[model samples]
Target: MGQPVMVKPTFEKLIPTIGSSFRCFDRTGLNLPSRWHRHPEIELTYVDRGTGTRLVGDNIDSYRDHDLVLIGSDLPHTWQSDQYLGRKYDRHSAIVIQFHPDFLGEQFFELPEFEAISMMLTSARRGLWFPAEVGEQIGAVMTRMTIEPPVLRLIHLLEVLSELSSCPSAEPLSSQGFAPSLTSASETRTEKVCHYISQHFRNPNLSHEELASHACMNPSAFSRFFKQSTGKTLTEYLNELRIGLACRLLMDSDMSILDVSLEAGFANVSYFNRRFRESRGMTPREYRRRYTEATETSNT
Candidate 1:
């Protein structure tokens, strides 16, 4: 969702330093790397600063400062910064930690002392997201690990994991029915179609015929292939992307509802309102109000 880029998720190979079984990176740049990639290692990522779209497995959403998420082994993911937001900082900041599931030892997490964390790892197979406040609380520890000695970093890593494992409010990002297709490499045609959709979804005149032509398939065949590869119909996928963008606009700007609807590619205001309520369980105004109130309270 970040770039007009879509492809079979490339497998990334990571090598840990000589003394550590895990790797940590504290990165700052104009934007985070927006690769649709996967790896054998599980990942914990905290966005110390930035606003952007987050794609994990089959889930897509907007993320803001203090964002935190855990990606299970081999889950495809990337974060793309919105060029329009937070330009004053001229940089995006994040800390990433990656480790094998058995980084500690084959049976380390199997012990009673790690019962909760073990359960958490299992749940992270679908991707786990913690509240922004959780990120704020643990960000300093993660930041320190960037420069701490190996043994000290390992201690802090466990402390961070222990705290996260005890958080009851962490939410799963991907749906229960969603599954990553490691075999996606063989689906180049589907990837091309997806890439095109990502770029043109905001075009109100976008049509199935046009997309099918881009994929060089009949509309009927394209529909079947897209559904099989992504577990979502074209309309369903487009709506989700638009809704995500709408939510971001609601939170980041004072755009009127009609303006937000049009900017997000909806042709009609009524339809946008209906779909927004269905997805958010509230009107756009309500969603904006709630987010604003929560942000103000946090600031206070």
Candidate 2:
């Protein structure tokens, strides 16, 4: 074989007007994909209604009635709804604004006046929730931006970012893995495999054969497709999945190392310890000890 082909990450981009540096979209009623994707624009989104899973990076959780979130450049995320197929909720709506950091100029953010805004963008890499108290104010500004002229909208955008940066309490969402890496579109064979792995990650015996069968592909074909699409071997992806859950357990529960390893899909403690160390740079016990100490320090 003449060298295996290498695939790069998929990037979705925003299209701005010929002279404009930003784009805005407001949807009164819509259904967004649960598929994970990333683009290189800083995004600010306000969800007026809808409920279901909200994924940012590797953080998996539920979102409800109304949410105002800011996602940094290229941080993967999605708002998977609970709606029936092809159905749209009357009250389900959203406003999204996407822009590049250098929209004004390459050095705009380096100016003294733009320091706070730059910092806010940096913090948003971990994702952000514009604390409820200040959300309405920011949402109102975001709305005004959609109808304003490009010049005025830029001003409104600055006003919104400034307010968010100075809020008495700025809250960060998502975990340390802020880069968008995992993804699958709904009903695709890749999606089927993702669903399968998610449900069966607690079993250490997961193999390429079983995954291929579940996705209706032969082993060789599945391996080729998976690597080409995701740019990672199946085993590497599964190991990351297990380690992610293992981190949660280490932080939130009192489970022993062996138990946590088993629950996260390691067949035995030795393998778990080795993989955990490879991923986290620390053994399970040390990881747990550091996390607990940090929690205790914060509480006290």
Candidate 3:
């Protein structure tokens, strides 16, 4: 098999090219997948308007307008925007800052005054999420960054980080399982497997043999490795993926339960009904009805 294609974030597209040093600025109206990429530079992102899901390492979470997050170096991550909101709301209107720890030299973080900032950086290796109020404050600072010079922008960026470090409510997104590993090849291979699964969840023909072949591993090894890495077996993971898609289709499409199940990759109605109930704790028809009723209530 060919070597897996691992995606990494490219800094070439940002406004005012960041050097091999610490930098800060605003990036407005951006919509692009960074892919399964990583870099040496740590990133802080604050979104202004959007609703989507974020995949940071192995953790998946739903995000909406005003979501602010910080990610560490060489940890795989991506954001997928909701298809319906793509045109109505700008997907990537936000502020982004990237900086290397060495930008301030090796001794800067060792100082007593910088201890909290240092800890924050270390904690961020697993990713961090700022609370709503703090996110708003960070978003405001990021908005101002677009108008400031490099020097002032960097200063304000430090202030922002300082404030974030002190916030008692800041939530860590990923834990030890999501920490960055030094092997790029392994990371890329893992991402390849995940992307493949995401794209093909609706295909009933998808099998363990095919996925293992795609990852260039034998079936048993791939099964073991995948479970160890993701904390879920291939069968369980694929079912969850399919059920997630089914849930969305149930809410958005007018298809019947049997058709929805068949479309979502189940072999037959009985099996689909059984699996759907197991995964969601409810029948597909009931889920769809409740979801539609809830949406109607919220709109009114």
* True-structure RMSD, every candidate: 3.1, 9.5, 5.1
Reference-based TM-score of each model: 0.87, 0.59, 0.71
Candidate 1, pairs of clashing residues? none
Question: Which tens-of-lDDT digit does each residue in 20-137 have in candidate 1?
Answer: 8899987666363356677889999999887777878778888888999999997777776665433543466789999999988999999999999999999998899999889999
Q: Write the per-residue lDDT of candidate 2 for residues 1-300, one digit (tens) a residue.
A: 122122233357679865568987686644533445567799988876565445565555445455778898877666655442244454576789898878888899889998988888988898887665576667777877778888898888888888888875776776664333334332245555654565566678888898887767899988887765444678876887677767767765788888888877889999989988988899989999998888799899
TM-score ranking, high to low: 1, 3, 2
* Model number with the top TM-score: 1
TM-score of 1: 0.87
Query: What are the lDDT scores of the predictions, listed in order?
Result: 0.82, 0.71, 0.72
- Over 4 Å off in model 1, which ranges? 1-9, 29-33, 85-90, 187-195, 293-300
Q: Considering summed lDDT, which 10 consecutive residues are worst modelled in model 3?
A: 7-16
Residue 53, candidate 1: Cα error in Å is 1.9
lDDT, candidate 2, residue 252?
58
Of 1 and 3, the candidate ranking higher by TM-score? 1
